[model samples]
Target: MEHVVRLEQVSSQLLAVVRRRAGVRELSKIVPEACGIVWNVVRAQRVAGAGRHVAVYLDDQINLEVGVEVSTPFAGHGEVIGSATPPGLTATTTHYGPYQRLHEAHEAIRQWCASNGYRPAGPNWEMYGHWKDEWNNDPTQIVTDVFYLLVADGSSS
Candidate 1:
């Protein structure tokens, strides 16, 4: 799919996350498990949530912070702890399709970055839109935003 990629400065989005070191291939399984743990903590503590989940990829090894968005930062419950997506200039795109195809959006951002001479400065992330019942039948309704934190040099122009 054609992704409309853009560069923007975004503030950190606070999350209750669980850190995990998984291989690229293990993400599909591990992320959900970690997110569930994060959610459980949110529920158990009655933390106000924003109804969305995010996964922050910290490195090439696929070390990541997977969790749901919370209204405010809170204390850790075992492995689930407070974290946030890094604030910086980023190249981002919104993918409207099934989650399994989110790689396309990430690739689009990478391609855009390469052509535009913007190197990734830090972590990248995916903020998943809230689930809708209709999305079950219409995969196009699913929304996942992909972002790559760009090196904060004056090269974004």
Candidate 2:
């Protein structure tokens, strides 16, 4: 039930931020709160007068030496911050289910990319669309788009 999809070039303006170090155990607790921190900034933008979406891009591996940075101004305590931009190419797909299943969709895209001779460049970010109402529970109604930044032939820029 998975398929390959193309992504039109997109550039997003995001507040800078730095992600704090966390293991799988700590991630379960930190990620949600970090998302909230970012979301609050998104909401405030709406309150001010912007009508665009903001997303956080994470890298697969953190450089313990260099650390990370988020461009988004909103940040959690001790977060490494920088603005996220799309790499030149990406393998994009839509995930229609609860947020919990996002990992499954990501794995599907990752495998697809590998089979097709593409390697992942960074952590894919989910672009949120319309707010979910009761339909959130219905896998058929829920819609989440996943984008994997890709590097063809695994070349480093």
Candidate 3:
């Protein structure tokens, strides 16, 4: 899949998430479960203007947090917890297809970082836009934004 990777600055944002440690294959089940938990919390709290769904991958073991963006931090309860998006320089790209095709967008960002002399400094994440009914008919209409935090000055700490 063709992708356009760009270097951008990201601001820290609040999140309501369900943290889990699962392999890549398990994410298909884990993500939806987490989303369900988070959405219920959002509705109960009556948080207006909640943003898109997000999955923050902290490691290969899939230390993941399935979440939705919130305007401010809140006390977490049960499986749903509060977190913040990492802020700084990042390599970003948008994937326009089904979730299964998301790996291509990640690979594209990795290649962009390598060729551009940047190195991943931290975990990466994906922000999924609001779902559309038409996406069922044309999966390519689905949108997901991928972000990889980059090391400052390309230096290893």
User: Judged by lDDT, which candidate is best?
Assistant: 3
lDDT tens digits, residue span 1-157, model 2: 4644664455544443335555545544555566565445545544333222334446545211111223443343334344554555777887776656667777888777766777777656665446557775565666767777776455533
Ranking of candidates on TM-score, top first: 3, 1, 2
| Candidate with the greatest TM-score versus the true structure | 3
Give the alpha carbon lDDT tens digit for every residue of 43-125 in model 1.
Answer: 98899754588999999888899999887876888888888889888899999998889999999988898888888886999
lDDT, candidate 1, equals 0.88
Relative to the unseen true structure, what is the C-alpha lDDT of residue 25 in candidate 1, on a scale of 0 to 100?
A: 78
lDDT (CA) per prediction: 0.88, 0.54, 0.89
Evaluate model 3: give its TM-score: 0.95
- Candidate 3: lDDT over CA atoms? 0.89
TM-score, candidate 2, is 0.63
As for lDDT, the candidate ahead, 1 or 3, is: 3
TM-scores, all models, native as reference: 0.94, 0.63, 0.95
Model 3, 34-133: lDDT tens per residue? 8888999888988876889999998777898888998888578777888988999999999999999899999999998888888998689999989999
Higher-TM-score candidate of 1 and 2: 1
Off by over 4 Å in 3: 155-157
Clashing pairs counted in every model: 0, 20, 0
Q: What lDDT score goes with residue 66 in model 1? A: 94
Candidate 1 is scored at a TM of: 0.94
